[model samples]
Target: MDKASVDYTLYLVTDSTMIPANKTFLDQVSQAIDNGVTLVQLREKSLLTLDFINRAKETLQLCRKKGIPLIINDRVDVALAVDADGVHVGQDDMPATLVRKLIGPDKILGLSCGIPLEMEKAIEEGVVDYVGFGAMFPTKTKKDIKLDRFGQGPIGIRRLLRTLEKHNSSSERKIKCVAIGGINQSNAAKVLYQLNTPTQKVDGLAVVSCIMAAPDAAKATKDLIQIIHTPAPWTQALTITKEEPQSLENKIKTVTAKSPLVHHITNGVVKNFSANVTLAIGASPIMSEFGDEYEEFASTIDNICLVLNIGTPSPEMMNLFKHALQTYNKYGRMILLDPVACGATQARLNVVKELLNYGQVNVIKGNIGEISGILKLTSTYKQANGNEEEVLMKGVDSIAQLNEDDIISTGKQVSKDFKVVVVISGPINYVIHQDRYKSIPGGHPLMGTVTGTGCSLGSTIGSFIGAQADGRNKDKFDVYEAVIGAVELYNKAGREAAEEAKGSGTFMVKFIDKLFENTHNI
Candidate 1:
């Protein structure tokens, strides 16, 4: 179950819309195969046995043709019906040990272990090939119940490693842990990367809704698998902005002067600081919530941008984000969402899910966890073992494991997934839009230990977009350029000030120094 040789990458499970029910059925299956999914799970929830058999036959054929492995979820009968590649059972969904006995070896066998007890039972049973654990986060279809600790988030890479350690003594089939729950393009690598021990790490991701829901399902599937299948050194820590050096510089200066006014429906922790950062960078800042003035406000303002955070979530605030988004659409305003602490809690992440339905966001900023929740990475929506104890969250910040590449990729993926600019801000700020990637590697390390840097970055972006809306600047100050520019200015300041500052107390002074320099004197 270690991270070294896990097979969890590129795992896909077909749980909904079975067997070419429509003309696109086979096309979808073909696309999944084309996307590089290494394994497929046929999860037939409500189909009649005969209908299920027929679909399984077709799926098995398609999978075999592609040379991809196939597993049937919760149905040992189906596994034998089509001589499917494998069978996945749950705590109550036919014991894997028994299914193994019935199906015999050579074929694969999978078990779903939602908790430690279930894991022990599955392990004791011993016939299982690999174990599946989750509804790791929260899902409507998964029937999230109140149990001791049935549902949780990514549980940090360290804890996931530990959990794998606990179960290492089990089967020699190389126990594989897969982090499921809303794993998306932005954060898939983060989850996989966190699984430190190759022997103990989960195999790959298991996504459902995301790949199925995209406008271009095939492209989405292909992209997700392409990135997943890509082995390490992993896309380098950061990539580049193809705008060319002159173009990039011009875009930055032009955007700052244009002065966009960004709207933030984000955390209270950095409200004031975020606004200040925006103003400091020569962009106007507007912090508004959902209210009678939402649409009205969006309409009145030409350069409108939106940001949503989960740090200090309130129902009132949540409602405000909804209204603001409504207003954003009415005005065709550009918006950005920060899925902060997204996978941390059901309530916190629900806001992100709801917001996804509303189109018109120009960017999304988040850490790895938030991004994973947004995408629902692979076939299963579950995390590996032992994470709750290790994954840390105080407010909305990422205080767990370190994954620079995954963080950077999360930003790049935001651009790809939503067709918007993505910013992953931390000790270093990564502004990724489209295929081009750029890293602003200047921020002080202390920035990570602080509170408002992230919120401030989002607000900074909003301000830049607002300025662009004034019609005074060239189109060069697009979202892509704005993000890079913001990171450069923000980090340059942090690093410069860190040279003279000793602690957080002096950090404020140096931050101001850097911010002031970047905004005016620079």
Candidate 2:
């Protein structure tokens, strides 16, 4: 069989120890093949050489009978003895070039790559037929394997997408990638969809215990195949619905009545403003940044919503943010990220990237410059001399030239990339969730004059999200509606405050009062 003709959709790497005591290893393999597994690799490390060769021959025959390719794992001698279709080697195993030379030209060779650089090396050397990219998630199957030696540890969906991006840009020949490690029916859809961008996607899913340890291997295989092919509910494009004024008012009433706890692990610079904004919008605010206290709030607080702001980040603060985000995600709660000045420094950008990559952020709220920085867009501004100066974000301020289409496109792309609602704040606020986007177009210029308004806005959104959770409206919570309502409410309060205030200082106070008044009236 030719390597190019192989169908790797559901690659199975056999671990006989994981099979049920009642079922033979061959029986499970046959059932999985009957269901939908497209490829198989016989991996036996503890068996004696002769015993391994015998098992390889038997497995190869079974696979050939089913017209499926069986590859040997880390045992080129056994693969040669059995004349197996291929051999898969790990990073520390026989080098791909040497393996190719030993196996000769017609036989297949699969190299396990943990990082993009290794993948690049494989393509550059032109030695392997395919690459196995993983451990995409923590796996008990390969618990003893030291992943750090390979320069990656469970490269999550985001990192996997990045590795694939690097590979596509550098190599002209298409190299098939089969994702291994911790892939199961529960997370197969996410591994397939979330790991994919508009341009890059994994060609197949490689499994160990998911099928090997299953009571019903056929059913497990069938179920995994189904999930891999079907679109996750969250990934589907939702249409924007026009929200009525009455509906918005009712949502506000729910917030006041419930007063859900909105936890802010924000910067010290904006902690007071964020907490006040949360309270004024009819939500209980808890300003806590200690990682030690995260478990208490995550466990005890009801209808909890977390706001993670990177306005003043330290390694300790970033660690706390990670803890909070993981806790919220574990409880299936909402988390809003305010990436303040993410593009200002390499440290800030790295911290934000780490948070986004690790956490399942539900909402990302930032100004044009911050959002552009997070998305890595080349944003520029007009200088006093009427020349375009590349915007190097200095503080938590937006000095970039604003283009409506560019902002909208960036918002949409970021939303899709993270599978999260993105709110880009400016003169026109864009609330984007998947395909649906709405622009809330009014805010007093005085709003920008106040410090931490952006952080406060994120806090306000967190309050609404918490309220929605309390109202038992999570499944029904319209992300676009919630964002639009938050922006509209804040904008209206700013406009009212501007009318009554003499200056930015007075406007800040009036704005808080207006928020309370609006909530009370609703």
Candidate 3:
């Protein structure tokens, strides 16, 4: 098979050890191909050399007949012996340079890479056609898995893709990328979607048990292909349009009319203010940290939105937050995550990462320091000094200094990385969604004097996004526009309230009043 005539999407890596009792391995492979598996990898780690070569030749016949490439995993000799389409080698396997020389330029060459440096060396040698990134989640298939190198999940994969992009900038050929290890129907969509960015994306997914071990491989393959082709509900709903955005008054009118139920699993200090802000925006608020009620709240409620604040990120609270997040994700409900004081403590950073991986988040709102912290979570992020500067915090407030340009760029990167709307709270607030971004430059100095204004802004966003969930506004639901509307309303209200307030105490009251007046005026 020619290397150029390869489709890397939906790669099936065979593992007969896990195959079902009644199922023959070849039948399953054929079934997967009959459905939509575009590539195949024969990976029998324990089979004898003769047995391995025999299996490779048989699989090659099936693959060639189906017009799909068959890759021999970690066995260049077997691949050459059977004249297979490709050989996929791991970091510990024989050198790729030798493998390429043996296979020649016409056949495909794949590599299993977990680190940027490993990929860097491969790109330097110019001996690889594609790379497999992961061991993304925990799996029983590979027992000797190195958790340190392999379990970094999408964070690790993102770093690897950035490395490929860095090389692609000057290289003649763009290398293909495929994510492997523990991918299944449950996570394939999130994995592919989360790993994709505006600049780069994973070319395909490689799986073992999802297709190979299934009792009916065709149905399994069809389900996975369907998921890959269909956009996730939230992702589909948030697609940016070329037309002009709706008027701010009309956006606020949707919120008041729908009054989305904003569920706040937030900190102790901000509960009252967050709820008051929710009410002021004409949304119902339910402040519940009780983990037991999360299912009913997420599954039963209509026109619901979840606002997750990491202010009180105790171990127990984090568990509850994750449960609520997953429940909301299961129902395809909207979520707004406030990583409060995320850069201030290691514990908070850990919690934010956990929440990010646990479920799909529609929006992430934070200050410049917190957003900078989120940017640092990606291994490739670097500042001008080529060192990650610490985000200093006094109590829950960030003393980390970042200019406006830095804030906008940081917000943009975070939005791209997490696949969520990013709102960076600053003097000039910035809201970013995919390729679209807006800079809203209004808000009074007194807004900084308040304690829960930032947290309450999350509540406001929850209200607007909740309205987007309403069937009444189904034709008008645009999360990017809704988030833009929320930030502008909050900032403008802060400016108006600051004009009428005597001090911080009165500014807080007037801010709520302004939210009510402004939202109701529509």
Candidate 4:
């Protein structure tokens, strides 16, 4: 990939639910562009071939108008139908070499290369434009997959950078590589730094959930663009932007300053952990899910931040969620819905969509599998044969087991449709909401080793945003600031907690312990 072609150096990818069916997908893509989205991808995982072709054609026209390239995910036919700038595919979805053949030489072609071996494969193929790596951590978007192959450890990202460096390096084929899965506002800096390796790193970052999951979609896209354009220092100030805050990472400083209270009506597995993580991230947490009191709580709480996480949903719990959604929408409170287990089954994906469509969600967070499900639901692309079968995802974890480009392309599509933030959590968290995007560089793989961690992070961010609503932060930097505060706090605590604990159990305990500790930076 040529450096000049990638203007921002980092890009935001959306999922279908990130937009609504009743809305215009192209319009959503345009909104992100207005916000600073540099590149766009059309992913119609669910729509029929003809429908996907139509939608892609429509979206591609918009992207071209903005001078932003449109990359289609999974289907070469759709890309051709729309005259897309490129197509992104995984190992199983379509071979990179074959995709290049289909698109001809003028268009871009990206492959999913999470492990060093895959990077080698991409090199061997020679037709790939850029390579994507990770499910940085476990995410709600593509729940069932695990990111073992990337093998960065707590510094798995550094390892990924090193591995990518080994393959198609300027010393070799000179291909570009970007990180994906869970790359978001909070962790953008950390991810980029590691990629830079105290040295100029690969081409750029391809993001999903982080950007897609923010309230200010436009700001999210811009932030990520800033991170991509600004390389980190080799020595200190690991911050993505100047500490002055007015710089690109302005949203981040605004977020951590307020210890906002986030209210979550989510699953049992990670509630306490989420609360602790929130506190650590310089926010407060109020976990209340009683159906009867929800409306009352919604009314009384000054900071109305709600997280609808269906980690283990029951009919009754879902009903409560519906009620909560009603309360949130009525009050104009910030709401984030993690479509837990969305893609594993058709019924689940449909329900997730129902919840999102029914609710006024500020952001939608999930993994590749879940995002794919949303695309299948909203877009016209039929889930290609062997696509799901090839996917060996297990739960709502951001850690990836597939290619990175597929994840980012889907994330971008979702972000465009929803007209909100869409985040696909992975190693290098992509936090893109419009032009505002930030890629948090590094945390611990232990993040996923502990269950409910992803859910907790989402809940924590909602709470931080809630503080502004609660009148806790008179300054009220913005919703994106609150999210950054939440993510930073969670990561710092997780990194600290990782010190005392080796396994998941200990990490969970220490994570909570650190979240509650005041000695650390909020």
Candidate 5:
């Protein structure tokens, strides 16, 4: 088999033991290949040498019929006996260099890498064609291997990306990299998109149980390929505008016409304000913190959006937040997370981290302190010399005056890491969705004098996102645009409300009224 003819996009490794009692191993492999599996590996660790060779021979004939490559795993003798397309070796198996010597250069050789150092060594040695990197997530198939040896648990997507970078910098020849272990349809998109950087990314995904254990192997393979090929949601850049745009007015109308239900499980202090903000934006509001009601709301509500704020954190509230997040995920509804005062305490940070890890959050609204805390950057404050001087944040407020570059970088990193639109609140609001970022640069200073404004902004954004979910604009729905419109509208209302305000109390009252009045003409 020729190396150029092989497609590594959906690499399938066979585990005969996981095959159903009703089905033969070859039946599953044939089904997977018929659907979209580009490559296959015969991994028979427990079988006798001759038996494994015979199995490989049969599988090779099947793969050759379909024009797909069949590589034997760990057994070079079996691969050589059957004249298999190539052989895949693990770290403890025959040295890749020796395997390369045994098998001619025409065959495809893949090495399983557990960490960056191993990958670097393989590339420097230049013995293999591609690298199989994983235990991307925990898996029963490779349960015997020590996870800690691979770096943090599961060799998470972020770390895998870093390893790729290291490989690129160290090696001149380009080699394909595949993600293996515990990958499935549910997390296929995350594994493909999250483990990607501007300079480097994995060429394909390798699976054990996901393709082998699935009842419908063909459908599973097709679905995984679809996720791998789907365009990333954040590819479009965030664009900013200064004028009173027609798009903003149109989105506001959509919200009013649809009357989307904006559900809130926010802090006790901001419940009233957040609900009013939702209502002001022409969306119905529901405030509930009871975990028991989540299933009811999820089942009943049609045009729904959820807002989760972690300002006032408690164990009970955390449970409710998790419940709502999971329910909304199932319904495919947009969820807005407001990690208010996230940097103020360890408890708040822990809650924010858990929610981010558990759900596919649509948008995350936070202050500078909160966003920086979430990214785990060095906490610093601006000195009198207009420089970012290092200082630990002891309170909730932001002490450092971050420039546009700093804010944009932080926002993009957060958006990429969590696959959500990140909104950092300040006098100049910065909104980032994937690779694009928009900085809306107008708001009254007095808006900062009040509490719950940030929480309210999240509710407002939720309303706009819910309105966009009506399928009429599903393909055109860009969360960055929706959030920019929401921010511009809210900021304009704040400027208008400040014109006739006497003090903080008057400004707060006027701001809510102005938000309601402006929605009519937005």
Candidate 6:
């Protein structure tokens, strides 16, 4: 088989230990290929040389009969004896040059790459046909990943791909990329979609338990193929703007008409205020952090939105946030993340990183300091010198000494990298999507004097997003417009409330009253 013609989509790496009790290993492999798997890799690490060769010969016969390419995992001798189509080896295994020499040029060559240096070496060696980038999530299959660096997930994959571009820009033989380890039905789409950036692309996914360990391998393979071919429900309906956008009043009206359920898993400090703000915006509010109910709530509720605020970063709260994030992603629901004081402590920063790595977030709103912290996580941010500049956090409030231009720029990069709407809230707020951004400059300084105002803004945005879940016309439900409309409405309300209030206490009441007027009109 020609290496270039091989289809890498839905690659199945076989593991006999994970096969179902009712089915034999070859039966699962045969069923998976008959359904949708494009390629197969025979990996029998526990077997003796003779047994491994026998198994590889059998697997190769099944793959050849189905016209699917077969790859041997780290056993070149077995592959040669069986005349397998390819061989895959890890960095710690035999080097790629020797593997290519041993396997010769006609057979395919795959390398396991975990970091940028490994990818750079593969590009320089120019012998690898494809590279598997993983342990995308923590899984029992890959026991070699002991450090956090290897467990960087999708974000790490993006970085490694970007590194490839830097080293091999004009090469005609572009190395195909595959994500392996811990990629299952729930996160397979996310891993594939998140890595599909403008600069980087992941060709396919390599799986073990998703198909091999399934009760019915054929059905599992078919379902995964459908998922790969069909577009994810959450990835569509995005509004991209190159110029100034039109009025989003229609989007606002969608919220009032639908009255979408907005779930808030926020901190204790601003629970009541956030709920009131949600209600005032013509959306139903439910503040529940009980992790047990997330799956039911996400699956049953139509057009539901979750506002996940990390103000109180307890271990319990962090775990709940991860559960809620994954549930929302699985159900194609919108989620607004508020990483409160993300740069204030290392613990909080680590919590936010895990959440971003876990699921797809629709909208992320934070002050300049918090947004700056997110920007630093990506490769887009550059320091003035080699040293890292400190961003001060005054107990959930930002005192980061940055100009408005810097904030807007950071918001743009964060939005582009994460593929979400970013709101950098302050006196002059910026709502940014891929390449476009809208600046709303109306909020009063006194709004910051009140507690929970920023947190309430997240609730308002989430309400608008929930309302955008109109099944009538999913294309018309633009999350970008909803987010921009929400920020504009929230800021306008703050400006109006500040003019009518007597003090900070009165300002909070007036802010709610302003939002309440919108509900009456709706």
Estimate candidate 6's alpha-carbon lDDT, on a 0 to 1 scale.
0.83
TM-score winner between candidates 1 and 6? 6
TM-score for each candidate, following the candidate numbering: 0.51, 0.71, 0.88, 0.48, 0.79, 0.94
**Model 5: which residue pairs collide?**
238-436
| lDDT tens digits, residue span 366-391, model 4 | 76666666655332233232354333
Worst 10 residues of 5 by lDDT: 377-386
- Report the lDDT of model 2 for residue 458: 91
Candidate 6 off by > 4 Å: 146-150, 241-251, 382-389, 469-475, 519-522
Tell me the TM-score of model 2: 0.71
**Candidate 1, 1-522: lDDT as tens digits:** 122333557677775653334436556666777767777887778899998999899888888887777788877788888888777776666656677888887777777655555665655666666666555456656774322322344432233334556668553545665666667665555445434343466677788766655556678787787656654222231233344443434545655665666767777778888877767766677776637777676677665566666567677776777666656654556677777887566666556655654333667777655655554421122342233333444456566455776665545544554455677665556677766777777587877666787667677666655555222254334456656666676777788878888988788767866775666653
lDDT of 3 by residue, 1-522 (tens): 667668999999998887789989899998998899999999998999999988888888888888998999988889889888889998888899999999899889998887777888889888899998877776786555444322457876777878888777777788888998889887787788788765678999998899888988999999999989988655655545666677888788888888789999888988999899999989999998777877887677767889999887787887788788767876678899999888887667777877786678999998877887788776457423354547556566777787777777777778877878899887788889756789998589898888888899999999989878322265646788888889999999999999999999999999999999998876
**Model 5's lDDT to the true fold?**
0.75
RMSD (Å) of each candidate, 1 decimal = 10.9, 6.7, 3.3, 15.6, 5.4, 2.4
Q: Measured by C-alpha RMSD in angstroms, how accurate is candidate 5?
A: 5.4
Off by over 4 Å in 1: 1-8, 16-27, 120-125, 144-150, 156-161, 165-173, 181-201, 209-217, 229-312, 316-522
Please state the error at residue 2 of candidate 6 in Å. Answer: 1.3
Candidate 4 vs candidate 6: the lDDT winner is 6
TM-score order of candidates, top first: 6, 3, 5, 2, 1, 4
Q: Report the alpha-carbon TM-score of model 5 versus the true structure.
A: 0.79
lDDT of each: 0.62, 0.76, 0.83, 0.62, 0.75, 0.83
